[model samples]
Target: MLDASGYTVISGPVGSYLAERLAAAIASRNRWNGCVWLRRPQRNLRSLDAALAEACAKRWRADTHPTDDPRRRLERALLGSPEGAVVVVEVTDLTTAIGRLMTGLRPLASDRGVRLVVVAEGLRLPVVRFAPDALVAPAALGGVDGLAARVGLLASAPVAARRLTRLAERRPAVATDLLDAAAVWPHDVLLGALAGRTRTLERVTAALLDLCTPAQRSALETCATTGYWHPQLDTGVVRAADLRPWLVPLEESWSWVRPIWLAPLRRALARRGPSPVVARPAAAGPGSPDDRRLRPPDDRRSRSTGDQGSRSSEDQGSRWTGRGVVEVRLFGGFEVRVDGVVVDFPGRRGRSVLRFLLTRPDRRCPRDQLLEEFWPDVDGRAARNRLQVAVSGLRSALRSATNDHVIEYASGEYRIAPAVRVRTDVEEFEEALGAARSAGRPDVALSAYHQAIDLYRGDFAADVPYESWTLLPRESLRLRYLDALDAAGRIALRTGRIDDCVVTAHRVLEVDPCREDAHRLLMRCYARQGRPHQARRQYELCRRLLAATLSVEPAPETTALYRSIRPR
Candidate 1:
């Protein structure tokens, strides 16, 4: 049912056993790709949690976006799932669940084919009006007597009850077969194959002798003989014996037969080749941790493939120049230096505008888009005027250092000109990270990563909430930076640079205290560094923060790390 549809909702009290039963039923049905939405925070590590954990360990991808409200989480889950993917949501109470039902009904109703399953303690008809195609009452699981009693509660007449009982008894195997058939090929092929496999001389003769019109079975025999498995094939009567000869000519002419047979062989041959492996650099010393935490995210690293001309010293318009170049450094803080003398860029908005353009130099940003981002709450006219002023100030600032126009306004768009030598700390950080990722020496990679961290001043484009355009990239870069730090810290610990790992992990915790991996890594680092007390402290802090914020305990892996570090 879930596979045929795209969504399902399961609601019941916490620890009510319904979630596990439903999950087991879904898994037994083999809907491997369906996602189960975990709503109740208190129910973690219970039967349902264990079931989900097992499911994920079996190669299913799972992502958790912790939220306080079940309703909001449900909305986000629905929005996030890829189109046509099954969604199983667990709700704790009938009242709250029914509220969600009403809100979600419109969207679910629009997709008439999607399935909705609601589970609760009792099979009492829900006041919320959703007529499910099938209902399973848990009380029926007791025995034949219990099942009879539950069946009696339904309004179905005695005749219908007996019919349903018989059908229910026969349905499981048929459902299994149908699932198996669905797995093998398209529905039409399954139908054709089943028909062909069942056709016999006795059945054919019986139909012919009975003077009955040829059934779909005859057409299946014709198709099997003709090798025409397509749904568009003519449905005409043909003897089963005649099919083999007709199929011979058609099989040879079919275009897809060769490729279909060759695919697995081709894949097998491809797998025989040696897998390519990337060699990473050695880990850094203890100091490396601070460096990794301090660095900007690696994605914003510079990708300039060519050398740019430096700011020229000959022109009086040049701000300051040496070696015919002006170097703009973006690490830690934004700075443009000509011959080592810093050129001052005026105004906050001007600086922001310049930084925004320089971040993705040469990429055009439409005027309206820029205005909306940089000053979203301001009126259109006021925003445009502010943008104009910012741009003018930025241009004037650039003019102080060089004859070249750094920022260009053209074709109803704004962009930094290619010739401007813009050196960004974020770009440098990313480049270092890339080098580290590719380095043959872990120490070298660690050093590069450290340098990258030194370049980060604060959050990317900090104090720019009005700029909605930058929020996604900003958050993405922030997470990447944190991940890279964790990776570097792990490498440091592995290489016996315990002090460095400790510092690095601590830096990460400063930015995000809830990072369990960083906490665990730091604990290990402290243990190796002979600071058992510090390790214990880190564990305690993690326990406190996780409990307070998420209302959950640290994962077993984290607990194990702490136990390993505790003094004997």
Candidate 2:
């Protein structure tokens, strides 16, 4: 289905069946040494290399020696495989490190006569830089006939096929969904009005919209309601949606690839009322104080779980502009605020120094260790001097914002002041996760879990992407976020929030394809919605993933669930 050699980047739409289709095609070929699919690349190159090595070992069942370096192990595995063997690597979350890793492994792979194919999504910098020989867009379903045939709607239900083909907008995932929804209809009424049915249309539309970002959703809603793209919008806005494979250019404007989205989009917009214009937070410069704070440190009791104790609009924003609390935002980016004012670090090292201390368990680090971590290249004496300067600058920056001593130095160590009331998004997210798991009521648990999921904007200390020390904490927080999402998804499934349940299950699978429980949730969700075929398909996916990654079959429970839902 793809080139036998070199890299082929597949810019498939997110939350679509494109990857699964491609995987199936590759499996049919059955002529590979080993195909390693990394659904989400770990933090560093070594971890990714280890995954590749592990996959190779499992495939060959050879003694690749776990103690050997990953690259060495992979080299041995590739050489030992039969000549002309094909090795494909399909990575969903492509990072710059993964791109470089593939580039480094390409020559060795080629020398061993093992073909390499790298599949990725989006036009992100890493994808562009990989410079694959061929870039394939797997968005279009080859027009109406192709989509109809693929979804098994062409001959089985012609009228339904035509309507659904248009509704799918040439997107395979949407076509699959429409097919599943239509499966519930009686054969005689398969041609009945589908677009006019608000319930069915709303269900599919909501699922599709959930795939889009808030910005993309707003742009699409404007195009749907106004009959033209927003004049004020730039090409970036249109291009943004274009990247997703669901929107197409229509004349000078962008329109939904699937026309059926219009009514549902309008209905959703009506419920949302006016879309509020939120200003982007200004980029923090050296020593620049942030104008707004995240939340008050002592406002811990006013959680989002209940309406009575929930924070008001003012409190949610920079409401408390006093000297009692310090807020540290460390999810997407790093920022520190004292008394509701953003504190600017004196320099990069100063910021890193503060981040290093803040991330530690005790919020303290020995001076010597700090010097080793932050100034390892410098001579010991000079590194010590640099650490002192960095700490001094950080302390000076904090003092400028408030009278409180946010950083303290004592006993050859520097730490965040015990007296300073510090609150961070990471802490809050974990708190909410704990609350959700321990909550007495389902509703409370659901609310808390959702809140925790929302609080995780991105990975921990995102600005310091390549820092070795950040990886553990970043992965830890990410796993926690996924846990919260899984918990919330189960709740939504129980409460009959099918759209939310489906969305969460897909999200979990995206980050961790081997998650059988998430796959089971999706299967159960489809079964409850009367889409038995989709439920069975989800089981097949689960089976495939488990077999490929772990060389194991589906768990007994998963198999039982599939059997129950299968056509008897």
Candidate 3:
């Protein structure tokens, strides 16, 4: 038994018995309304209908709507219902149900006085746009005793009502509300708030309503809406309007056109403001090649002299020497070699720093970007100091090994010099694949691709966890490399290079067993090489792997390949 005031989500497998018990309890109370959200109505239709009927008989209005029809049902239930009505939305399949609820119910719940109960069997409450007022996992209901006791309390007097409210607030259900509010607020504010320190939709709404604005709240909202402003433009001095023109275009394009656009804007604004103009060097006559360049040479010479003296003062600053290859082997272990010698780079942090640089060699890596990628857990001065130490160690290591300073620091950025020979196995693999596409001889290209395939010992730093920066490129390169092998294998088989084709196809399968192309290539290679049994066996293995991993049968192409290889 439950009261008219509370909302619930009856989550679990359709015939898990928990749904029936929840229905019976709600029925006894005669105050709750039930709505079952299921993926496949045909499977759970009978049981759910039975539960709905039982709840309805007890004076609780009940309905069943498939997750696909959530928007219609939720709108009908919320807007159409009498005041203080309790709606229980049963989500039989968590994924489908969550998707529907997040897309539909969240906005409705936010605007109206409605509470959502997500019934997912084993899942934590589905993350919705607008947080649910309460969350009740069937397991947390703690069997029949806890469920009955809570229901009985809900049916009791006003004193019991206060206790029930307190208990429900303590439930994990409250987290749903908090997270939901957090999810929708920022975006809502960004779209809603026209002025003030509104960075996110959440902050705008919270500011409009005059809720708690934590020290970082405005800053976070600014970063979310306007992009990260340079620390030089301290929030104390700078306002949101100062950022909007550039921010609007950048936000529209979804480009990080921050600090980049900000610099020019700041200079323009400063010039327009009450800032004193500094005098420039006197111009040379018309014949002089840009007087600015001529005046700068004398100043540049003096600065160069100063830099030379400073360089002499420092101990062994000339480490990155000569135009030699910076070989980065990023399979098995993360290794960096200048030419062929394995230089000892100081600190694990420094090694990681170098690895990041080597991955995108000859490109400018900003200090902030590096800090965010590498020392994400640390913040402010600590992260900066760590980066400085790592950069110093990298410079020292390169200088000691090669006797040439190849890593150039300029304009608050670090880059591997263009002249330096940077050779990564990944890069080499890409190069070989490029050659294969253009080479006049298919066999020559196949050989080069095979060599490239051999270089990929394993997943790029397989030991490393999935990082936001590395995962995308790593997976992309890995997939591309595998595809190249598949293509090369097909070419090899077509050219009657049976042994080479079989070897390369097998290698492809080792990395990705369900690669349909690899399976087809291998089958064709085996059959052409007079190995029908092996071809059939390969098909069976692929079929099993596909079924196990993806829960789907092999495509017609795969079965066709097997049929072609069957013993006649």
Best by lDDT: 2
CA lDDT of 387 in candidate 3?
90
Tell me how far the alpha carbon of residue 16 in candidate 3 is from the true structure, in angstroms, after superposition. Answer: 59
Model 2 C-alpha lDDT per residue in residues 516-539, reported as the tens digit of each score: 899899998988888897788778
Candidate lDDT scores, in order, read 0.48, 0.61, 0.50
Model 2 — TM-score against the truth? 0.47
Candidate 2 residue spans exceeding 4 A from truth? 1-310, 313-320, 339-347, 396-404
Off by over 4 Å in 3: 1-324
Per-residue CA lDDT of candidate 3, range 1-568, in tens?
2321234445542123344345544443233543332322222433443433343234334253445243454454455444334445444344433434443555664455444444444334434332344344422332223322433323434443343244333332322222223333343332233222322223333343333122223322324323333332222333333333233221222222233233443343333321111111222332111111111100101011111111221211222233566767675457676755667776877877676777774656888889999888997799999898888888888787687676887888878887787767677667767876787877556655644554565677664645566787778878987887777777767777676577567667767878888888878887887878767867876887799899998899989879877684
Over 4 Å off, model 1: 1-334, 375-385, 463-466, 531-533
The order of the candidates by lDDT, greatest first, is 2, 3, 1
TM-score of 1: 0.42
TM-score of each: 0.42, 0.47, 0.42
Cα error, residue 368 of model 3, in Å, equals 1.0
